[model samples]
Target: MIESPGLLLTLLAFVLVIGPLVFVHEMGHYLAARWFGVKADAFSIGFGREIAGWTDRRGTRWKLGWMPLGGYVRFAGDMNAVSQPSAEWLALPEEERNQTFQAKPVWQRAIIVAAGPVVNFLLAMLILGGFAMAYGDTRTPPVVGTVLENSAAARAGLQPGDRIVRLGDRDIHVFEDMLSYTRIHPAEKTTVAFERNGQVQTLPVTIGVDQQTDRFGNNYRIGMLGIARGDRVTVPVSLFEAPVVAVRRTGEIVSMMVETIGQIITGRRSVKELGGPLSIAKVSGEQITLGADAFVFLIALVSINLGFINLLPVPMLDGGHLLFYAIEAVRRKPVGPEVQEWAFRGGLAAILGLMLLVTFNDLGNFGLWQSLASLIG
Candidate 1:
């Protein structure tokens, strides 16, 4: 575990960020269950030995656990924290069964299972909406005010007053779009369509690559066109419109995530890019150091990511449960319990394998393994 002051701060930041996110996710399940008259046995913020806890008046044990990485809620009929049904639930009296989660309608069960991810998405929307309402969009238009000499823009015959209309197939809406799109394609040939005076013109340009370093000493290569913003515009959205903007932004992030996953699965990208708890801690610490707005924005981003990850069709996840429920709905009966048990077991194994892989990647990211190897050498 990280023990240095900076690393400790990172650890604290991870908890501060992850704690609320996990709470919100499980809270979604808890609230939905309560709404449907299902009794919750416990609501926990972590796993293993309890650090602190108290039973609520409703007999729900609210507790914090030693492991601060993840959490769950135990319903009345649950065999364990994963919400598997217990045999006792099956043999319970009608009154007791009525209060159990499995006793509810399958639709209700699906809702309860799905509510965690839904709440995560909603939490992200709320945070993003809050940001939009507070700061508004301060971005500028994608018009070239000046083209640097000997840069990609100048070489492409780009001149002052040219308004960029498109980059390849993507329609340019603002200067941020141009910068964001180009920044990833260093040293690559790209087609730029712009409006010069009254006519639209297209140009073939090779993006310039620029290497830069962050405060963390990590280096990155970014594409550069060397064009400055022509005019700035701040569009302040109404509270009503903020959520819509937030949703659109969330959609963008989700789309990018999906694309990245597809790339990874298709071998276009490496699985080494996948991050675990250490990456989150590092990024969370960096964001916290930036300021409240940046940290909250990071929270929104991570929350959305959490929601999306849980929606995957892998067993032992919220999405896996939903998938089973969908199959049950179509079949008009639940999958056999033995099949579920095996499936969940397999799911658990898959999850553990993935966790280990990502943790190894995290260790590599922190240079721990490299340090150990060098020490041994």
Candidate 2:
């Protein structure tokens, strides 16, 4: 059972983590709309009834919502928070129509829709770059300093002083690269290449799986190579190079996310590993306990994920709007309102279904279902 302090921390951490992200995301849209001279009717941090907020000089109804799940920017002449074009708003007089979102050219509308996710990516890059500049980067060579006795590396003929060159098809540049590759391929047979005394050799090794339980009793299964790294080097990155490092790191993270999703699609990974708001809250709390650095790192990771998820071509998402704009560009006319309405409905259903699945997974992870079963029994 969670203690009172821990529970409170989790709640606070969740708000701290999610609130800023939501605000940043919506602000991106609002800013882009304003740049195109589109009037904003409302700017909310969350959904549902307003908790507290004040209007800006531009007459935007900037308000806080009671439900803190997500947020939206309702542009003037929008039918709803999703920014669907209102028939009456579209039929406004020429002078007034100029300030509505739908009155803008297709390119402008697309930019406004795309800005939210782009800002999310930018936010992540900025945070990561700041860390790189402040703490420097770790540059540990992927040389095996020790091979654990009777472990997979030992059985595979790996020895001390072997400089790991590649794992399967992935080239191991640093120790962290090797670790990243191994962590995702637990219990799978993989090819390892290393150099010893100027001679390169390859061997097949089945990665060992290690099941670990965290302080919160959450279990994780990770792959282990049973080989340790040598000394590490920390290099200070220059201001000009920090952005390059941040972009590279962000790309690597996106690649990992893509690979994980591909694994799930191929049935190589379990869908039960999928998480929702509860899992995020738990993780946020745990990271807060670790330190501000750890918690901030979590924010960057989640920001990238939010950006990537929004880019998926699902209806009702930013990507979905872009997809519609793409179709409109090709046809030289907007998609039929009936078609858009149906597509959005379908999208909403898919999103709701996914939420239910993830929530169920979160409950199981928290042992809620198991505890209820035990109580009934």
Candidate 3:
């Protein structure tokens, strides 16, 4: 735990940011389960020894535990939640198990399992779009700030103070819009139109691909037309329409996540870009240092990540359970208990291995191991 201030920040970040996200995610599942009439025996916000608790009228134990990394909902007939096998529950006498999870319809079961992550995603998008509409977006004007010498833009006669009017036939208003359009369609030739001082002109510039290397020694080819980010402009939201901002933001986050997944598969993105607990802690600490807004934004971003990670089709996650439900929906029966047990074991191993690898990487990144080595020497 002892390291630089940055490391302290990272660890603190995990506790503050990740804890709430975990709470929100579990709450989603709990709410959905209740909606489906599944009787929850205990709802815990953390694990280990209980810190504070109270029983509800329905006999549900609502408690807060000492540890704060994650939480869980114990249903009436669940065998400790993480391993709630359907076959065992089905064997219970009909007179004894109306409120058991196994008795729920497939649709309800699927919804209850899937709701946790879905709510997190929705929360992220709403914050993004709502903030955008409320504060207006900070954007750069199309005006060029500085043209790098011998860079493609400079070589192609792009001058300082030139206001970019359009890319191809697409008229760009803000800096972000231009950046977004250029990133996806990295064309070799771009007919860029701009206004020089007061006069409009056009520059047909050849795009050059730049190679950048990762920490893992992987290389990525990034195309650039030699233009730099411009000065920002903030456009505020109008009256009576700021509420829909969050919805738009949610769509944008979903689009970004989808693109990230696609890029990783296509080798356009590096897998190393995916961080583990260490990364979360580091980002959490860094954002907290920047003040309240940045801190809140980091919290929401981490929440989105939590949701996305759980949604992956890996066997031990909520998504894995949903996958089983999906299979059940198709086959009109659950996969065998033996298969489920093996799948669970394999999935659990994969999760543990991944956690260990990411933790090692994080420690190295934070110089924890190296610092200890030096001290021992």
RMSD of 1: 3.2
Q: Report the lDDT tens digits of candidate 2 across residue range 1-377.
A: 43222888999999999999988988899999999999998999989999999998989999999988889998878865445567777678878778988889899999998999889999999999999999998889999989998788999999999999999888999988999988888888989999999999999999988898776667899888999888887899989999998998999899889988988889989999999999999999988988899999999998898889998998899999999999999999888888888888999999999999999999998889999999999
Better of 1 and 2 by lDDT: 2
lDDT digits (tens) for residues 1-377 of candidate 3? 22233666667766888777877888898899888777888988889999999999988999998987578888888863344546666777775477878778788888998999998887776667667765886666877777777776787798888888887656877666566555544435778888887898888876666777643333456666567765567778754455465665555565667776786678866565656776777767766766777888877777787888898888879899999989989999887767887888899999999888778777776668999999999
Q: Backbone clashes in each candidate structure, one number apiece?
A: 0, 0, 10
| The candidate that achieves the highest TM-score relative to the unseen native structure | 2
**Residues 1-377 of candidate 1: C-alpha lDDT, one tens digit per residue:** 32233877788889989999999999999999999999999999999999999999999999999999899898888764445456766788888788888888789999998999999999999988888888896568889999999999999999999999998666888898888767756677879999998899999999898898777655566789989886678899898989898897788778768866875788755688889988899888887887888888999999999999999988899998999899989999888778887888999999999999999998998889999999999
Q: What is the lDDT of candidate 2?
A: 0.89
What lDDT score belongs to each candidate, Candidate 1 first? 0.87, 0.89, 0.75
Model 1 segments more than 4 A misplaced: 1-5, 80-87, 148-160, 184-191, 197-209, 221-226
C-alpha RMSD values across all candidates: 3.2, 2.0, 5.8
After superposition on all CA atoms, how large is the RMSD of candidate 2? 2.0
lDDT of 2 at 339: 86
Error of 3 at 344 (Å): 1.7
The deviation in Å at residue 177 for candidate 3 is 4.4
Cand. 2 TM to true fold = 0.94
Clashing residue pairs found in predicted model 2 = none
